[model samples]
Target: MSQSGIDLDRSLGYLLKEASSALRTAMEEVLRPLGMSVTHYSCLELLAQRPGLSNSELARGAFVTRQTMNVLLQALERDGYVTRPAEAPVGKVLPARLTPRGQQSLEQASAAVRAVEVRMLSGMTETERSAAFRILRSMIHSLRDGDGNDGA
Candidate 1:
């Protein structure tokens, strides 16, 4: 126990944050050579799965601010990685889609990210892995429920 706070050595939240940080570090290491940050890779992955997603959607999916995602989307558009109509199809919502180049980039990034995930899970048995996945999902659901969020 800490003299002033919760016991760091026995805190699940602290341990979870540590694991998240480690995972981000590992993802960054792998994605750096591919010319992408974790957020960049996340944006591309989200777009690949849900083409024409708006800036706000990408921002939420990537755990980034809307302005941050907007800036990244602009860069991606300028670099020919993604495209958005000059005018919004609806009210100020320019849905973004990936270019072929973006898909190619995403393919590489996905492989690198997958390697990192595989390495992270290497120590866990298949059964343990499944249980861990379920437990994490439950934790997320519980937190969101407590906060009055459906987590949609």
Candidate 2:
């Protein structure tokens, strides 16, 4: 068997990476004025949707390391955007909740993020958008499941 370099223009992996980079750039542009990074917004949104989430849980939800999430939580706490008790109520797990301020901030950031998504899907019809969503979810599931050896 022989191998050749990828044709970047026709490569699904390359195209996905390119799309991810563009999406991140667009999100950053929209979030900057709101004084939020994607991670910051993610944490708040997570807390909002699932109140009393532990640091480890939030770290997973936000796709960040525990240490990174801890630092961000500290900053958010000091800035009065989030609240956690001084001591863990049980088992060294200090569940965090968004403060009213955090909720307000998240509302704005969510709106900004939604705008970026709308812009990204602007060219697609509703059916195309639904298909795109399903396809992307399937791709994520396949990658995460890691069922392999059938073919590359």
Best by the lDDT measure: 1
Report the Cα lDDT for residue 53, model 2. 98
lDDT of each: 0.97, 0.93
Residue 68 C-alpha lDDT in model 2: 97
Write the residue-wise lDDT of candidate 1 on 39-83 in tens digits: 999999999999999999999999999999999999999999999
Candidate 1 clashing pairs, residues 3+ apart or interchain: none
lDDT of 2 by residue, 1-152 (tens): 12676678889998999999899899989999988889999999999999999999999998899999999999999999999999999999989999999999999999999999999999999999999999999889888886865485
For candidate 1, the 10 contiguous residues with the lowest summed lDDT are 142-151
- Model 1 ranges with Cα > 4 A deviation: 147-152
* Top of the candidates by TM-score: 1
Residue 11 in model 1: lDDT? 94
